[model samples]
Target: MPAPRLVPDLVPDLVLDLALTVRHDGKGGIADDLDGVDGLARWVAARGDELAEAGAPLGDFVADEDALTAVRALRQAVRTLFARAVRPAPPSPADAQRLLPGAEALDRLAAAAARVPVAPRLTWPESAAPEITYVPTASGPPADLLLAALARAATLFLASDDRTRLRACHAPRCVRYFLKEHPRQEWCKPSCGNRARVARHHDRHRVESAL
Candidate 1:
């Protein structure tokens, strides 16, 4: 069975989770996931508030030493994020590297993402998807394959021939991504839509008065 995608910003959150490599707590014990291999739990720890805000949570669940070390490093970096944000500083190379790890499964997902060629047509057949496409082998699709498939679809939609249909928010401050409801729709929400309408009215009024 395809592993269910965790509902809370899983793509972004999973990226964070993957960056975390769990290890020992230092007293001496194996981690839940990464053994003593030195993994990304620190990154997850650092994003505590972010996860909290996202209705998810980041916890220090590692029991292994190597994983604990990496998690500590990530926590330190995350701690400085807000302070660093005050300046126009760019992310450090190490921080950028955390977004993708060297895992083969992740590499396969990346390759799949690159090859995604489907258009963003939301047509669903009677069967949403087979509960299982095929039996899982060690080399078969990654556990979170449904999300991987969706991620691939999203990539394809962005790269699609009908690129104009993919819209970024018209309101500069709003950072949400959305698809255009109509060919002319620019704002992502009705509130932003209403704001735009008012702004246009003022511009028109000013032009007429100036004439």
Candidate 2:
């Protein structure tokens, strides 16, 4: 089989993407894309445009040890809340035991979102429709700003109707949370569905042999 594709851009929610940084490694183990400072920098760069749109522009952002630690903390909180949102469903097994309490996660997200001041600004091009975008008002540490924007995104997603569509991918070894784009959507992707079917087939085969 081809490698399990862990695409960060698979979802529109920045918070969901951040949580998905932890995923299946295709070897019966979990992988963390932000395992180190370098990995954190790469992750930030990959989401530069989206971050900028969300009012936390970190152009050419460089990740230091502190940045990596802070971002990872925020990610932990986000994942905790994500697990809560998909209640009655199993969360990704990667940090299943390490999730923060629901109340604590809410506090963390609120605090992180307040790290930088932001205000909604409206703009319109000559031939385009008017739109509003949140823009940071003051300067702060790159990590702090990024965390604020990401937390805000999480806040909005959790409070919006879209939260109902979020589901944890329970396919074997798939440590991912995905937005249920359609009614029939089960796993995070088609590949995960294939893996799940194969695993079920093997289980049935074993049961038949036992009989």
lDDT of each: 0.37, 0.82
| Alpha-carbon runs more than 4 Å astray in model 1 | 1-153, 159-164, 209-211
lDDT of 2 by residue, 100-153 (tens): 988899898899989998887777679976655567889998888888888888
Q: Highest lDDT: which candidate?
A: 2
What would the TM-scores of all predictions be?
0.32, 0.88
Q: For model 1, how does the per-residue alpha-carbon lDDT over 97-168 read when each residue is reduced to its tens digit?
A: 333232433344455443322222223358664221211122222212322333332232223333334343
What lDDT is reached at residue 29 by model 2? 90
